[model samples]
Target: AEIAGEYLKKGSQVYVEGRIRTRKYQDKDGNERYSTEIIGDRMQMLGARAGSGEPREPAAAKGEAKPAPAKKPAGKFDDLEDDIPF
Candidate 1:
């Protein structure tokens, strides 16, 4: 609520991860209208910030390295035992 109310402008580009629903309702004039609502579980603001010219990036793509599992090998035979006869 705070982010949308304070940070987002009328044309702010955002990526929303959520379920969307489209419902049909009648207006006061008895005219049919379709409304789409997004229930965003996750939302990200795209493009530059309020004043910054440079575009922003997601946290994972911003050079944050995730430590891989210790047991993972670089190659198929990388884990071969030294005592293997084959």
Candidate 2:
């Protein structure tokens, strides 16, 4: 909740690492319901905080929990126009 309450703004970018979890529950009406959520084990802010260039670090919920260090993206990027034939 700390991360969401703090850095997760409408346009803020974020990187999340975690697992998908689906659970069954009931709402106010007591009707059966299902919720699928990403249980973010670690989350990192994508860019710098507003009005500053220093990037914000991740916030950890677990004990002794500090945010994960800034790391390179695990995914690969494809060449955009470089591979295109003119």
Best candidate (score: TM-score): 1
lDDT of each: 0.81, 0.78
lDDT by residue (tens digit), candidate 2, 1-86: 78688767888888878999999999999999999988888767777789887987656555766659879766546634466577
Q: In angstroms, give how far residue 1 of model 1 lies from its true place.
A: 2.5
lDDT of 1 by residue, 41-76 (tens): 877888888788889875553566976788954766
Worst window of 10 by summed lDDT in candidate 2 = 73-82
Off by over 4 Å in 1: 21-37, 61-86
- Per-candidate TM-scores read 0.48, 0.45
The list of candidate 2 runs beyond 4 A from truth reads: 24-33, 53-86
In the predicted model 1, the residue pairs found to clash are none
What are the per-model C-alpha RMSD values against the true structure? 7.9, 9.6
Error of 2 at 16 (Å): 0.6
